[model samples]
Target: MLSLLTDQQALPEPVGPLTMFGPDFPFAYDDWLAHPAGLGRLPEHVLGTEVAVIGGGLSGLVTAHELMKLGLRPVVYEADQLGGRMRSASFEGHPGTVAEMGAMRFPPSATALGHYLDLLGLSTAPFPNPLSPLTPGTVVDLNGESHWARTSAELPTAYREVADAWEKALHEHAELSMMNAAIRRRDVAGIKAIWNRLVPKLDDVSFYGFLSSSPSFASFRHREIFGQVGFGTGGWDTDFPNSMLEILRVVYTGADDDHQRILGGCQQLPLGLWDYSPGRMAHWPEGTSLASLHDGGHRPAVTAIDRVGTGFLVHDKEGVAREYPAAVFAAQNWMLLSKIRCSESLLPGPVWTAVERTHYMGSSKLFVLTDRPFWRDIDPATGRELMSMTLTDRMPRGVYLFDDGPDEPGVMCLSYTWNDDSLKFAALPADERLEVVLGSLAAIYPGVDIRSHVIAPPVTITWENEPYFMGAFKANLPGHYRYQRRLYTHFKQDGHASGHRGFFLAGDDISWTAGFAEGAVTTALNAVWGVLTHLGGTTAAGNPGPGDVFDQIAPVELPED
Candidate 1:
């Protein structure tokens, strides 16, 4: 969800100070990371021990970095480049200007991820969301008509009606205000109370089902418009089939609000952490960093994994095989079923089934550099910017304008689409995609010549087509709560047999809130806690890790039967 057409009067009563503290498993990962006591202390013998970390993405990096701080030597194996989906592709000869092929906007509620961003000293600017205060203007093109507006109030009454319907539906069925208050206050009891009651009732309900069941959304036209231009981000009709619980998790925690973009690029977070030297660490010497541990680079892709005796044996592409007492698979979960070879004994039957059942959304983004901020030019007749952030029903779906300065090359995301909309452009080459996007935009801005300002070749990515990442991110379907829980809690392997105990899972897909980076960070921390506990480590007194508090604040579980 990336575009929002929110009407201030139509919105629910305001709630303040929200963070991504779970509506499922409510744990303060930010507080845990900030604790001076440190994550945990490994046994003396476990100190300096090698822990194999598969995948060099944000989750993998966070897992490896924390493992290093806990006195364990981490060997990171990346099938692709570092930062995974947090990729920032720079145009030729353009340094700061980049095409954010993956993650771009992030909500302030991603407090766990914010911890690392703050640590890395990375700056953020308000992303130009549709109708957001930061945006100069917005254009909504649907049914072959264009409506330009600077704010929600400027839109036609029908748009406001759709927005109001959504707000009313949320308050009517989802208990939006109660959950918002609970999440804002970080009330574990209140969160669990509301979430537990709703989980069983709504686990099988789809986002569309939730809306259709609401009286306010009774009009099919309202639902259609609401899906095209959602409240917080852009259109999310593609997400209609997802579990209502999933949508609730995001809205409850404010994961879709107040979005910001990393000033330079988000990839810097992982790259910076790779080279960051934490002031306090256990067994490693001062100034030790993940980059230094790996000779400033990491091993090639992992080809296979085998449970050899009590430990696991990992084989890399370069024929390098290493053994580790414990390992973390932080890559896309689908990789285990597709790209990598793994022993059946590595995980239990149910956990493997959960992995097989994971559902992912396909996404594609196309970006091109322009000569200048031509969009800022005023249209003499209309007194509006020549171009504005766009949301449409056409093939392009969503278009965003990024202005660096009048003299600097500006960036434009010609298209940002998901699911069926994304699949339409997946097979097309970058040039063809650009042509289609330009064609769509031309219809919206009849007089404007968008392609004339282009300064570089278009760059595009289709996550579903990427060999390493088969899909953009996980999105649970109706009746998938059980499967989601299995993957998320797999890190806590104490209940598992000895063979499955040493192997761990981390990444957004393994989290309750799948698409957000906060999920990636928190899940990696969970794996860190799991690896620590597996190696006879204990959290500092008075600072219990997630595993320590598992029984007290575990995610609500539904009966298998």
Candidate 2:
């Protein structure tokens, strides 16, 4: 493995170099170059088939798997490697251990997740919990003094007034949920009522704006906590605006799972699928040349489709084309937009703009290997563990530690979310960013002297720079409520000339819990239901309604609206 830092001399040497080969390498640039003659490297002819699914991420794979069970042999056209963002990195020193750089854990509420696991014949294990007595808390550097910041407690005395104002806002928009239900059922009057209420709010006013301008509003200190807990910030002036009720709805209604980290890592899920499918599954190399489609009726159609379709052509970066009766576009929304050449524009201007421009959080993980469980010493005064000292703002937010050490051995993975432009880091010499990350680690854990005890070089996965995945996961900006609606409505198979018939959209983007494993699973289940409907199959078989698997799990009650 290439040493990211120049101070390698200061650190212990590794046994071997790190290799970056994986099933998930980006395939856009190379796959487009390997098309067969007379095919234009794109799907030129329209072929009739049962189904063709494009993009091989979780969404696409799950959809195809569901279709097969429904008696349809769906062809999956994946551009790069399978598993999409769920790529794992190999470290030389850790023989059996793998570091996951994408899609870490799944929530229990996602029935599809459990079903998919069973289908793959994989079992679940509780996420590693060493039970260190450290209570995780956010600390802010205030005038060089580290002060604990608790969102709800840190609010000023006047916060209640702001909360009251937010309550009133909720009452005024009390009919919003009804409007949403109406839109879901395609009720014209209901949709009209919603548009009437929402249009006035869209004029120069953002969600943040409404919150701040409200008589009861205050600072974002406490508001941010709500946001972190999946609640919308009650700030009116913020670009990502929503009623306080909507915020509460997210907090109360979203899926919850105490389990973290799959037993062998997330790769087990896909590996199980491959094992189950065996000869039926194929892992194509990037840039493989595709066969030509001669008859328009028999030929596959290459178009960016959100809905699952009967027949389509998929052209990979290698110029290889595969004709399938149905295709699932399972990659990120923006990435799919670039690959499929739609005959007519399905996504409208504003909706497409939101999909392409919505800022997503960037994620990077730092894996540290130690000879033993060294951070066991707890600080009795603050109830914080020695490992907890490693939390700092200089790097990313939500940094977590895993026990990948020997005997009690485990991996300590720290995650960071980038707030600024990632292009700035990509522009810098690679060594510079490495130096910054190392410096931050040094600040967090001064005792171990990572420079000396390091077993392997740090592995970094920059979600922002990745070609197929432009960013880590979806995060709606202030005043972008319409974007969420658009994600659901604009991609449906609603008889639009540009829209795909039977082609369905699924992934973290379309579901309510955007940027989570549960969202991906939920979207996949939804897509499966659509596929079943098209095949004259019962929805009950494809979608085992809510409370089927999770009813046994205890309910978690959050602050009620």
Winning candidate number (TM-score): 1
The local lDDT score (0 to 100) that residue 527 gets in candidate 2 is: 62
Which tens-of-lDDT digit does each residue in 425-470 have in candidate 1? 9999999999998888888988999888998888899999999999
Task: List, residue by residue over 313-399, the lDDT tens digit for candidate 2.
Answer: 555445556555444556677765565664333345656666676556665555555555455555566565555422233543334
Clashing pairs in 1: 2-234, 3-233, 3-234, 4-233
lDDT of each prediction vs. the true structure? 0.90, 0.46
Candidate 2: regions farther than 4 A off: 1-50, 118-143, 147-249, 254-259, 277-311, 345-359, 377-384, 389-391, 404-409, 421-434, 444-448, 490-500, 535-561
Q: Model 2, residue 112: displacement in angstroms? A: 3.6
User: Looking at model 1, which ten-residue stretch has the lowest summed lDDT?
Assistant: 1-10
Report the number of backbone clashes for model 1: 4
Question: Which prediction has the highest lDDT against the true structure?
Answer: 1
